[model samples]
Target: MTRNVARNRSPFSIWLAVISLCTAGLVGTYVLFVEAPPPRRIVIATGGKDGAYYRFAQLYANLLKSEGITLEVRSTQGSVENLKLLMDDDSDVRVAFVQTGIANSEQCDSLEALASLYREPLWIFYRGSKGIDRLTQLKQQRIAIGPEGSGTRGIALQLLKANGLGEKDDEFSALAGNLAAEALERGEIDVAFFVAGVDAKYVRKLLRDPEIHLAELTHAEAYERQFRFLSAVKIDEGLLDLQQNIPSHQIVLIAPAATLVAHRSLHPALVSLLLKVATKVHQQGDLLSNVGEFPSPKLTDLPLNPEAERYFRSGPPVLQRFMPFWLASMLDRLKIMIIPLIMLLMPLMRVAPPLVRWQTRRKIYLWYAELRRIDLRSIDGMTIEEADSSLEHLHRLEQQIARIGVPLSYMEEYYNLRLHLNLVRSRVLSILRGEAGHSQPGSHPGFRTEGGESTLAR
Candidate 1:
């Protein structure tokens, strides 16, 4: 009885071991191949504290905080400095807002673009009465081209060089931002260059100042044709302050796109989250861009990241559409393991049932082989003592077979083996009754039928 109980428990134990091993293998696979969770904190290189880049970075910081990520905005001079920070190997800055044409493909091989946030128009505010309409007209006049390392200065030098101006000309000043605006108002400089968003306070203040005048780039399309990175935009009359009808006439402007760039190794989940934030913050229409025009894949100088491309083609990752941010991030990390795990299970699914079936029937087949051996021996002569011993052995085999546990699906085979056992037992009993005549101790026993043929004859 104890042996029977042990036999029944064997298969269950084997199956338990197999399942446990499979679970362990799957966990190991996940640990080895799946990506770790995204970092909880990241640093972004932004422009001056009061500039448009800094303001937008603050908004992104607030939005990311709700998703359990902390955004650290590091203040810098402008796009030129921001690009430098992103390229430095030891710097903590993972992302930055850079202006178009600041870094070319050769200079930014380690960077990729997420999206172009908006267009930054080059506003040339001057305090002059001679009606300066083109860049060439500012030849010998004192011009504030913004401080060094500022995007405003970079673009100003390029435009000034296109016209008949150079560094040798002593009239260029390094003033920028509010300082440039104050200098223009006080007549310290004849013209001041500003590359800022329409919503900047200083730009708005200068636009409404009666003493100041905004230069209309009458040849803006020509400039765009010359500089592929520049786009021709128009500031519609009175769009800045509709109530007071500021800028009473339409102003033609040429601008460069501002793109959000990151290191090539940045986490893909963070890229998706940043793209989502950019869409919310920059999708509204402004003086330089129509609604939904910004945060686009256009006007980028760097190669777009694959994750960002997927976001532009579809929306966020499919899992993120229905779940919270943290849960969705975990699931996204696990997605790479799903296919390999399914492949691992496929063969097991096909082979497990057959293995179990074989194990269940193995004991029954082993007993059947023993019964066949006893039947063959009974056909030959045996002493009476030996015949009684053989009968007892047959009874013992039957008791063993009866105790075995067979599942309902295999009952037919079980019953067939039992019938065969009974036939062998009857043959042994006939030998004991002298139905099979034994001539001598060493001779073979033969059983005669009604037709007088030997039953043991082949």
Candidate 2:
């Protein structure tokens, strides 16, 4: 009996599976193309662990960690190497700290600036007897301009070229950090160019050295004019160490802002979050910048990301301002798909009722096609052998229909179909008995066999 019912609904079940697959396919396509979730992990390229970029990146990492994101701060040579990592298509690095004016025109199309982080003052320390107030005063002296693929080297060359100095490899050295400081003390190098924060170790070492004098750059505003990325920042007297009375007097210096940058394909959610992080990390008052001044859009050379631009113009996302970052991001990613999902569901809702009705009635009405086929052929004047065969087919069909189970709502259809099938069976039996009324067919619903007083009907 169970096998008979399984045979009845087998076609309907196959159709159901096909429709289910099609529906699943549509939703999968929507998720894969229209509205996908952002990655939970991100990679950021920064300078060496001792540099300001890596330190700032760690602060950013801590804040992002609270939001369920893993920010990997990968240390590199410097901004030049960081930019290369971001530009490489196969590289997983998406975010990095880049100095203003470090990216060239050809590379500008692939990257975007989130915000200007902080001022990295260009500190030039020389071992000469008299303080060299201007860049042109030092001629053919050994200069430590940092290593290749370092932002310090890029900026040092630009500054040196601007001062009417030639770029000869023999004239310049790649020494940096302790090497540059030690070389200066041993007179191996006459000058060392460094772009770093006040907290950097090398910058601090040079500042405390009495023999190495800081070059008082003349025409600080003129350098800012020549390089759009440069800004004139003032160092107040004893700002680094007030207890030791360092700097002796206040002096103006040219500086470049370290900008937080990302590739063009980085997720917008991350960009918005990073903007919020920049506010918390760099908005506080520092030595060179007042409160809320460091992360400003000023002094940034790369084109601003759309999300970052909006964030600076307004504020953090409305959802993020009040709720937890993870929850807020989830809601934002789903908001776009809400309408599309509703649109996809509407068709399924409409077609479901008719499809269900067909499946239910199919369980009962299926016998009708076979019942009608047997009744049409079993007519008056048929041979006894044909009449017995037709009657046998009708009995088999009636047995098959009896085993089918349907919902309570469809029980009425089930019983009515049984009645039609019975009438057809009675006609075939009456024909087999050769009754008087067996000459003509009946007129009941789904019954078109002979109208005869059947022995079974009796």
Off by over 4 Å in 1: 1-38, 326-339, 366-406, 411-458
Off by over 4 Å in 2: 1-4, 10-21, 27-45, 57-76, 84-95, 127-131, 140-142, 168-171, 185-189, 263-285, 291-296, 306-344, 370-394, 425-458
Candidate 2: what lDDT? Answer: 0.81
TM-score to true structure, per model: 0.79, 0.75
Which residue pairs of candidate 1 clash? none
C-alpha lDDT (0 to 100) for residue 454 of candidate 1: 43
**Per-candidate local distance difference test:** 0.83, 0.81
Q: Which ten residues in a row have the lowest lDDT in candidate 2?
A: 440-449
> Largest TM-score belongs to which candidate?
1
- Candidate 1: tens digits of C-alpha lDDT, residues 1-458: 11242355435654775677668777997889888898889899988898989999999999999899999999989888888888999899999999887877798899999999999999998996778788889888899987777889889999999987987984899898899999899999989999988888889999889889989877899999888889988778898988989779788889998899999878999999999888889999576777988799888889998999999999888877788778999988888877867776677656667767777777567676677677778876666667667777777777777877878888888888899988987777777667345443324333335454345421
Per-residue C-alpha lDDT of model 2 across residues 1-458, encoded as one tens digit per residue: 11266555643565576578656856675667555567899999998777788888999899999998999999998889988999999999999999887987565689988889889899999996797888887787888899887898989988888788877633888887778888998889999998888887777878887788899988899999999999899888998889988778998999988999899999998898998988899889578888988687778888889999998888898999999888888788767666756675677657767777888888787667776776677653556566666666667766777777788888999899889888887777666555424444432222344454323322
Q: Residue 143, candidate 2: how far off, in angstroms?
A: 3.8
| Residue pairs in candidate 2 whose N, alpha carbon or C atoms collide under 3 angstroms | 441-449
